[model samples]
Target: MARRFVTLDVFTTRRHAGNPLAVVLQAEGLDTEAMQAIAREFNLSETVFVLPPERPEHRAALRIFTPGTELPFAGHPTVGTAVWLALHDEAEGGGTEMLVLEEKVGAVACAVEVTGSHAGHAAFTLPRLPEAVGTAPAAGLLAPALGLDAGEIGFGAHRPGIFSAGVPFLCIPLASRAAVAHARPDMGRWQDALGASAAFVYSHETAEAGHHYHARMFAPTLGIAEDPATGSAVAAFAGAIIAHEPPGEGDHRFVIEQGYEMGRPSQIVLEMSVRGGALVSARIGGSAVVVSEGVLL
Candidate 1:
């Protein structure tokens, strides 16, 4: 059988600058093994298979897979898929539409902004709130793992910790952008320190003047040595920000710049609402461009 697929650059308005994703449409009969095989064949960070929604009202069901394994939920795939669907399925007029997509984690409600027939942006509220899953290894243990000194391992009130919205990541707060740029992962130490979780290293200093943070992600266990843009990581990062910054009640926003070191510059916008000194909700939004479409036989 031949499956129609679309390739998109997620989290960037331009092509070839953000994380690339392959979305297979009309994916009805493909089994789990076949889907995993297809994901491996794509060799991207993630591949999404679109199926009929189990619920009658939702837009579709998304099965997200990394090269090595399936994920319950992923950021770029959700954003890119929502934009692609909105552009192709909706009438060509500048307006916003709401879409519900079912994933393994839960149903995600996405607000898609359409600008034209082919260009659109999408944002989705996190289906699950991020929480600290566990504390990370001490700075002494994590320093060698990330090729950083113990002194460079943390920032004010932010240290190494594990957090998850739907997916878990070991969030490491570096001292500066220079440190984030200079750090390298030692696979041996990484295995010892992080074990099963991926590492999300970030700094308050950013490469872009307008951006609020700079970041890099390493997940060798998922066949991703480094990821250019990671929405799920940013989704979970809301918790870390709330813990450290503790914004006043009401809505706040930040732009995160990532992937500059790898040459693929990408931007992710994070919005959060707080009340009573607690984070009430959060959303991840970004622009995506449909680069190409092909039939996979």
Candidate 2:
């Protein structure tokens, strides 16, 4: 039987300006190999397979994948998959302010607010509470992997670290947005240095551009060289900040700007707070516009 899939460009307000994703609906019987094949066929950055919920309280079970491998959890796939379900009327809409989505990481709560006409898409928030895993990375090895000079990297007195809300990324601070924008992954070195230690290299600049930082992600491990907007990485970045940054003088919420270097121009909002010893209620959310929707066949 021929399977069907729908594609969308995520994170950007306009079409064709963000990361592209494919959603495979009615994917109940497909095995792992079949799913991977389907994802490769779409050839998008990521593809989501929607499955029936194991429990009645949850909305759906989402399986996320890049072209190369299946992921336990991902940022855009979670958001895009929810939107896809809402658009197809598989999940409820309009009546409820929040929806709970089950992924491999755990159950996540997504809040959707319809900001436009009923026929148009709505913006949603992902609960992105992430945790800091380690203190810092070896600058000697990491800087060159991102094609940057050691002086071009920023330690900010906090040091580079490993963080994750769902998926882990090594958050590296850069001296300038230009450095981040010019980043090209040195795959061989990155593989040798990172080597299952990190799934991606998230380079960021602090110069605000309608957001707290301009960022880019290079995951040769995942077959992606610079993701336009990384929801998971943004969430992890926020978590890392909360763990490292001094007590805020003001609000903690901020936006992440990414994809400009790649010409896609994407934005991700990272929302979180610190309570007790752990980072509580971390959410990574963003907007996505459907660029095109057609059957795979």
Candidate 3:
């Protein structure tokens, strides 16, 4: 049987930008190996297999995969899949629709505002709060891994550390966006310097004036050399934010610009609510546009 799949560019409004995701609909019968094979075939950062919900109230159960392995949770796949379901699976006639998707990590709630088009804006609150897992390698070891000087490794109160919401990321703060754009993984040194850690490098400088931060991610271990827009990393990044740039007890929003160096300019909105000097809640929001859809033979 031919399976239906849709590809979307997540975290951006334009086509051929942001992170590309392939979503296979009605994927109940596909086993894990089959799904992994299909995801490798797609060769995107991540692929989503949407099946009937385990629970009646949920919209669907999603299985996310990279070329190399399965993932408990991922950001772009969840957002793009939710938007695709709201647009094609449901007929809400243009309003905000809520969907609860069962992922390996847990049930994730998504809000899709259907604004009369294939393109849409979707956001999901973090089901799990970010926690500091550990500290990163010293700047000396990290600089060579990222092809940067030790002095460029951090700025303000930010330093290299590990954080996780659903997935763990080695959050490294660079002094300026210039360092971010120039930074690339020296793969030979990468494995030895940061084992089992996907590097999520960021800077306080913005490419576009309105955006508040800039970022790029590399995870060869997960078969992603570089990712244009990474929502999970951003979600985990809340920990890095709270650790370094402490915000007052209120809602704070930051628009992060990514993929510009890749010419796929992506914007992701991260909103965090702080209460009693602790992060109470957080949400990741972004826009995605349909690029193409096809049937798998």
CA shift of 8, model 3, Å: 0.6
- Compared with the true structure, what per-residue lDDT tens digits does model 1 show for residues 6-47? 999999988898999999999999999999999999999999
Native-to-model Cα distance after best TM-score fit, residue 165 in candidate 3, in Å = 0.4
Kindly list the per-residue Cα lDDT of model 3 for residues 1-297, writing each as its tens digit.
898999999998888889999999878789999999999999999999999988998989999999999989989999998888888855555434788999989999998865546788899999999999977899999999999999999999999999999899999999999999999899899988998689999998988898889999989889998989999999989999999998999999999888899888899999999999999999999988888989998
TM-scores for all candidates: the values are 0.97, 0.88, 0.97
lDDT of 2 by residue, 156-207 (tens): 6546778877678888777677877766778778776676544333344554
Whole-model Cα lDDT per candidate? 0.92, 0.70, 0.91
Can you tell me which runs of candidate 2 are displaced by over 4 Å?
90-95, 115-128, 134-136, 197-208, 247-251, 276-278
Cα RMSD (Å) between model 1 and the true structure?
1.5
Model 3's C-alpha root-mean-square deviation from the true structure amounts to 1.3
lDDT: the better of candidates 1 and 2: 1
Write down the RMSD of all candidates, one decimal each: 1.5, 2.9, 1.3
